[model samples]
Target: MNPSHPATASRHTATKTILFVVLAVALLVSVLVSAGTGQLGIPPQEVLGSLLHRVGIDWLPLPTHPTGDQTLWAIRFPRVAMAALVGAGLAVAGLIMQAIFGNPLAEPGVIGISSGAAVGAGLAIVFGLTVFGEWTTAVFAFVAGLAATLIVYAMSRAEGKTEVVTLVLTGIAVNAIAGAAIALLTFLGDTQSREQIVFWQLGSLAGSRWSQVLIVAPVIAIGLIVAYAVARKLDLLSLGERNARHLGVNVEALRIGMIFIVALLTGAAVAFAGIIAFVGLVIPHLMRMILGPAHLPLVTASALGGALLLTLADLGARTIVPMADMPIGMLTALVGGPFFFWLLRRTRKRAGGWG
Candidate 1:
């Protein structure tokens, strides 16, 4: 088939529309179902009712259980909200990185932003630091993550250009150092703190609260807004840096700005959600495969896809083991690990081996 055939165009369009509809519907259903699921098990009606009631709809019936309202407000809702936010943020960050770098595999974690965020958040947890009060962990994570990005940018620059290979290797080196730091902090921390660090590194949304939600929501929102605003530029950048520059794009400024946004989104997310990896790495590629490389659709579809994936993953984490809340990160890693290997092989094949 000719690549530019009208039938092919219409098929891709049809597929994108179907994917958008499916993802949106799935996300809505997942959120509602997850709200009703748990130890107490509220019905879906009550979940929808509670949502509408909060917005002043009194006709729908609420949960009958004595503690249902409290559980929904305090525990279930916050966890689900965090899962959606963190997943969407990471996926958008991943898409942004890939767009700016012009590499299908580019991701926040690939450049050590997640590891840096982990190190910063680990410091806050172990030391019980709260200088920024509720924002301490997030602030620290952003700073350190930005620092990590700077390190990669500096180390990988060769006469004003950064080679992908050098940037990735430098990021790996930074990640190793951060890992060692995390281990040292674990050793020095109290037993309680050590346990917190361990659980955090593994990633769980077990104890999320409204206050934390309030903190992370705006950070991700800001990144998403900026990312969408620059979507056209991202598309232009994909046509090669020199070409983008000739086409009136400030390639350097766009790269740096997008990198900063990635750090902000990734840092804020991992600050609260712990080290959830591969959502960033996987969602964008999957979206690209289905929706094509247009950054605008990629942004919207990737957000929905990431939110749906994480919400379902969180549901499985709690329900899969009887009376056990398996770490959410473990579940994502299960899916991502194999996908990563397959992606690596495909990427290498297309590039005719790594340069």
Candidate 2:
């Protein structure tokens, strides 16, 4: 089977197109279902109609239940939107990190951004820092996340060169330090603050609002665009640093740009949604398995896949236990932990040993 053959290329393109369409539809369905499920239980058709009505399409009749419109618009829709944005942002960030580091296992959290955000959130909780009013914790988390990424980048540089191994090691050290800081805050805080800190760590979309959706949507949109623009370079970088450079890719610039984009996307996501894990780590790998290593399709597929995974997780979170809003992060961890172990085992098997 010659990959360069016209029929082979055509088949690959057709497969990718079909997969993309399927994923896009799945994401749409997930969003509709997630928006409809809860204690209130609006039907999926009404949910879609409400969405259309909100956007000025008045053809679909509204739900007769008075609060249906309110619940769908003010609460459920925003929550679902946040899930989609955060999921897409994290997935793209993970894909970028994995490509830059040349490691299938790399994720957005590999650089300690999420840990840094958690530490900042801890500080806000413990000290009662509401300088930004309602947004104080989120602001702190976003700033801290960027700060951690910059520190890791600085530490990885030597004589105008950045090594992937050095970067990853620096991230490990930073994450440990951030974790210690969070622990210290936890130890010093009062009971109420302690509980707040725990909830932030666990991650949830419970209080999602349209305002948050507006803020995060643009950032994720911009990050995805930037990521897609550099997708080809990322694909080349995976071949090896020297090989990428030989092919005229500016490895350092590309690395730095990707690092910034990853930080922006991950920071915004964590700021709003807290520390949802596994979306970043799992979605990109799953998409790559289905879509192969092409970054263009990989990035798109990851966004849709992440959105689908989180939407469904949120649905389960709300419904799995009656009258309980389960932490969305816990659900993802439950699914992703087993998947991670399987991935590790598979990688080892392919390499024939740990080395």
Candidate 3:
């Protein structure tokens, strides 16, 4: 039950505010640091100055370095923006999945969408298809991801309802199939195609452009807006399916809408950034653990946490090896694997294991 006492209500509100402020500040700091820490090494002051200058708040001077403005506008800004958008989109997508499924373990990556998108991307690379010009891979990923989600949703439904265990199992099977498809594509490809496929599967933001960011942004924004609009319904959902229905929520409609939203968000993220793992899974779960089960604040907190994480990770990916780029999926997995184990232990201990 929600805390209705004035003191308890006030406390919850205060905590939510503090969390929002902290995460927002952290995300801002991470973005600035990432912008400044690249090869040309513009200082944070210069990064801020450049941004302010661009926006017509030109009190501060631009970067002193000759190529600073060019690099920031041409390269760093777009990549940083993409990372933030992808991170927030994936995190919110995971939140919706976990909410609808009532399963902490649910995420786009774990539930086969990411792998399905990978299959599409592999096919595009191996066959050298460019039906949509620069958008071929992204379009293919989105379509395949939507198809995979539909397949999982259709196959998992039994007695007009999707059981938690059944949905997860179906997802695993689908992921396995997608994995094999990727492998076959890899085998068919020559050296260049194989290398492209491998790097794409690994995930990176090395060459992000403003055009790609513009394409991804609107899709993610639509998903987030829809998710936020249904936050209260999701809170009812967390109470249980029967309870949600009793409270006048159209549980079926909500589930279907959120599933599509998840596919949309996942497609946008993976289309340009490739299959980044666990931003969706870890961020939502962590925020829920910290902020209680309130969906309104949880959604925003998770978005900020995810944005901060990916922004920093992108920075690390660039600087960790001096000049070589690192795969984002590997770094996120390194962090998420340990957290997932801990989450399992905590959940089991708290609930006496899953029902």
lDDT score, residue 92, model 1?
97
**Residue pairs that clash (backbone atoms under 3 angstroms), model 3:** none
lDDT (tens digit, per residue) of candidate 1 on 79-158: 99999999999999999988876676667777788888888888998889999998898899998888888888778777
> The CA-based lDDT of model 1 is what?
0.88
Off by over 4 Å in 1: 1-11, 157-162
Which regions in candidate 3 have their CA more than 4 angstroms from the true location?
A: 1-4, 154-165
**For candidate 1, what is the total of clashing residue pairs?**
0
lDDT per residue as tens, model 3, 1-355: 5557888878888988998999999999889899988668988888999999987998887999999999999999999999999999999999998898787877888779998988888888899999999889888988898888888878877786666567768888998999899889989999998987787689898899999999999998898889889999999999988999999999989998898899889987988888898888899998997789988888889889989999988988988987788998889888887886787687568777657
Candidate 2 residue-wise lDDT, 1-355, digit = tens: 6767988778889989998899899989989888888878887788888889878998776866889989888899899999999989999998998898677766767668888888887888899998999878777887788788888778877665456557667878988999789888989999998887777678899999999899899999999999889999999998878999999999989987888788788878888787887788899998888778989989899898888888889989999999999999899989987887787688668878753
TM-score of each: 0.94, 0.90, 0.94
Q: Given candidate 1, what's the lDDT at residue 215?
A: 89
- Residue 217 of model 1 has an lDDT of 94
Ranking by TM-score: 1, 3, 2
Mark the 10 consecutive residues where model 1 has the least summed lDDT: 159-168
